[model samples]
Target: MIKEKKVSSRFIYFFGAFGGILFGYDIGVMTGALPFLQQDWNIENAAVIGWITSSIMLGAIIGGALAGQLSDRLGRRKMILIAAVIFVIGSILSGIAPPNGHYFLIAARIFLGMAVGAASALVPAYMSEMAPAHLRGRLSGINQTMIVSGMLLSYIVDYLLSGLPATMAWRLMLTMAAVPALILFFGVLKLPESPRFLIKNNKLDEARRVLSYLRPKETLESEINQIQEAAEQEKLASQNTSWGSLLSSKYRYLLIAGVGVAAFQQFQGANAIFYYIPMIVENATGTAASTALMWPIIQGIILVLGSLLFLVIADKFKRRTLLTLGGTVMGLSFILPAILQKVIPDANPMMIVVFLSIYVAFYSFTWAPLTWVIIGEIFPLMIRGRASGVASSFNWIGSFLVGLMFPIMIATISQEAVFAIFGVICLLGVAFVRIRVPETRGYTLEEIESMEESRQAKQKSALLERAGL
Candidate 1:
């Protein structure tokens, strides 16, 4: 037996979760840079502005789909390196994009977005594969923490660099992504290929080698065998089912629940509310939007704090309990504003801000991070990659539509009414979780897969009886 090594799991886990930093940086950097870019280019079209801001999400949708399939075929490590390289190239290209070359910048942002999407999908799964059963939730939760930290980093950089000449200001902000990208590329080179991937490819000895480092010596052999058996079962399951079966009744309900939650999370307009917060505050408070300038930093802090709370409590509580509680609170936060607006027509706009702040804190503690945690561990191993991609795609689609439509939505309907709609969506989110979603917080991925398969078998039996087949 190979001797057990005492490596800092922290180093491995942090490197694995490093991709989240890139994801968050790309997301937050644009928020600050967009204003300068608009002034420099003298752009007046709202559609153009929206396109520039949302191109990343659009690229993410395409990237999520491609990364899912590629990670499965090419291996997780290779795909991560590929994403880092793409981030570097996209950042350099975007920073140097010439004045009046909006299309070029959009393309580069989309290119960077591809990396963001891939990282978003890959990090959770990759971290999930390497983490011990007891630590999985915390490790996966760390990925979210990294993402939030990156956003805060970008926000700080943007505020500090605001005094620079506008031309150079945004360029530096856009190109700053290359720093983390390079770090990620070099860092991943030192990590092992996922042991699960090695097992799936029939590299048994190599899988053992990886697990020897990943697991304690005492549990190493058993862990390898457990993963190996899971891989074999997945292969057999894949052989027995075609992709078409997923589209058919065999897996329809599973897809509906997974993909539905994914989409609903985004569609409830969290991002819309966030992206337009300054404007929203302006309307409510009857004050200059600049008064809210310090607020993004505040919100970013909340996001970071919320993610930290998740890391601490992730393994401690029941997933459904926290989710249900968070959803109910998030719904009420928005709905109460509408009720107040109707009841007290002249209610102070600061009240709206207060409720929104509450919403943000609750969201940080619940839906924002948990959405990723659930999707990361919930899918069966056989189609985990593809199904994750689908759910991710659904998420980006919701993001894209909401980003593109929210301004129009506000114009067509008053902002209060628009927020009311989001409130209703929140309640619906609660129903999905309470009734349809399963709890998988403490279970191993293989065990979760087995449980889902057993559930599917029962569903099939019920369908056959109902059809008299």
Candidate 2:
């Protein structure tokens, strides 16, 4: 019975990670498909291509802004179901989009962006809420892994379909997401609602029942107690929380920190590579566009492998240390390509591939997964939805900027300069994280919240005493 219960808990977590897989697939599928899209659509300029590429991110920005309020009102499960539906619609529209109607394709991409945005916010929160505290890191990390896996699968699918007729090929690639979207919708049906959502809704008994399925049987009672305590804390905190209150000094710093991390994650040039790999590869190798399209697959593979390796060490290492190291490695990776381009102007294509692969490897293991893990865990539950949404909004905004600008930047500036700029951004990330980000590894969410509140209370009291209030 114990073994069965343990297996059941594992299965639940696996299904939860599946949601992330869909998120990754949606984000990555368009990378390879874009080259074919531009040619088929008769796109003539970098600015136009950039706008088309970033249309989804613009929709995502709106979706992310709305996600918190909707999820809080509708419950995580329901919001995810809605997102799945939107994903299906977007996939179908994109697959059969009018051949010459670029605007229609943009509209479809925008719809898909909305689904991606909602899922991005909800999935990690759901996974974190459902996971046992001790195992939360690993379980949440699985979401990142699944995201990479989905990306890898997208690349493989694109590579395989690359030789097919362009119209059918791109359509098939975009529509492949429907398979995972359907799987996520059905998988979520069987999955229990997040225990936190239930507690927040005043369904304490239901929360406990859900906890039974989420935690191992032996740990169920203790998990329930932890949830009850956290709920009580949240209730007390709620008395002081409102949208307006978040702007005050007490909460302002946390909000800034959250948004900073989110913005920094994207501004570090991760999406530049993700959105423009084929172009980067073409610039580096002087390869034909068709051959350059496969480069993102190499990136996807390295991302999967690196993230898996990171999972092993994440628990053992300090989170800040890992993030710093990742930033440094990423910065160096960017510099190497620039150096090769300058010095060896005629460097081997394989060397360029090797260097780019190393860059992806560094990003996947460290910055990519850890940023989401830390963001999901750091904020208090009472304001988590809003705070996370705010942060995610910044993230998507940065994604939009990078996606919209990278192509133009690469066109105007040398590719070496583009990479050099990213390297500098990464170095700045290391400095910011080292100074501002706190280590939260091995700490429970409740404990972290308590610590933050305690500090806030002390600061508030100090100000009152000074003002003679």
Candidate 3:
């Protein structure tokens, strides 16, 4: 009766995007939890601290790869349900780990980390598959908006709980993820499996039924035909489209572009601000981490705003153009502080905070959301699962490196210098988009692959013409 009692399109997209909250909450929860962790556990070793923080990224690296392959075989919905279960169990276990259970805490975080990475990879794909081509960007963009909203929620929770005793406060912050994880579990159950996934698995009738709810009644037949034909052509091109074949020459460019954007999105140093911005603020202002609290809430608000803006215009512009514009502006935001510090060595430390806020504003609309959109939409159906997994793993790897290294980088060098390096990386990211990334706005996944094929053929023709006898 789902066809008759089907929810509105807004409900479907909102529920689909809910998984992102699981990832975002875990990401921001640790930021609030870590300060209390140091005080409650009396931990002082920098390496140990870095390990605890980065362990989630470590597990995420593994989980993204595993979920990619699992979603391919088991279907996206089932894999997502599995991830939600993992988050609940992990969060509950982390809540209880204290008083000489440091390793246990790390292990629990790894479990949650797996869930985070899986959701990060799966939700976008699921939404993109269900949405019509015209709405895919905005629908997939809902995932990013939910992600920042999750971050905002965690920050609000942290601020509200900042006054409680350290042990009780941090435990609550870490366990808070279970609430939304449970919500997503129940929510996804009401949804149909992705029509494309159903088609690929040869459940054509089921795909037709799902599309009856997802697409216009008149377009359902042609939509099914188009989806089926695309899968058929991809299957004929390569029967052995396993994870190992992603490295093949034909797919190498996509894998590279996808993974490159994913990695640089992290390496550009946005998370350093998210995870350790309080610490950065503490150092700059010569105050306790507690005093650094109000700023993150401000950040959370700006992040939510930028994501809201993305929701409005995501499908309105070409991907390459927006990404290029965002990167240039974000680069300037980072570098301008260093320039000011050099021009006046006694520049108000708060100037750095203002610049970082601008950076977040730019990030929310551009790299923050678009990276997920491109990763979800760029791959052909045959390799989407494994390729997205690989790309996501690289993203977590960059996140891990930044989380582990940033504290040390700040301890050893001037913080402005570190941000300047990130500025250079951002400018370089703009070049990567201009040269390597293709325009993907408003294109069907099948048509995107065909476009790539045509471009490759033209390049080959040009090479041959230049060497004509």
Please write out the lDDT profile of model 3 over residues 1-469, one tens digit for every residue: 4353565677778778777776888888878778888788987676667777887888888787788678979999898999999999989998889585778888888888888888877887788888897775466567778888888888888888989998998899888889999999998887888888899999988888888887889999999998889778767645768767788766777888899999999999998899887887887788777657778888989999999998888878888988998899889999999999999989898899899999999999999889988987889877876787778778889999998888888878889899999999999999999888877788877888887788888889999999992
TM-score of 3: 0.88
lDDT of 1 by residue, 79-159 (tens): 999999999999999999998898998898888889988988787778889888777647656777888888878777777
lDDT per model vs. reference: 0.79, 0.80, 0.85
Q: Across residues 57-148, which tens digit of lDDT does each residue of candidate 2 receive?
A: 99888777777678878899899899999989999898999887788988999999999888877887787887767676586567788988
- Candidate 1 lDDT (Cα, 0 to 1): 0.79
Give me the runs in candidate 2 sitting further than 4 Å from their true place. Answer: 1-7, 214-222, 243-253, 349-351, 380-385, 442-469
Which residue pairs clash within candidate 3? none
**In TM-score terms, which candidate is top?**
3
Once fitted onto the true fold, the runs of candidate 1 whose alpha carbons sit more than 4 angstroms away are 1-8, 247-250, 282-291, 315-317, 342-347, 376-385, 411-413, 438-469
Clashes of 2: 0
Model 1 residue 172 CA deviation (Å) reads 2.2
RMSD of each: 3.9, 4.4, 3.2
What is residue 454's positional error in candidate 1, in angstroms? Answer: 10
In lDDT terms, how accurate is model 2? 0.80
Best model number under lDDT: 3
Task: For candidate 2, report its TM-score.
Answer: 0.88
- In order of appearance, the predictions have TM-scores of 0.86, 0.88, 0.88
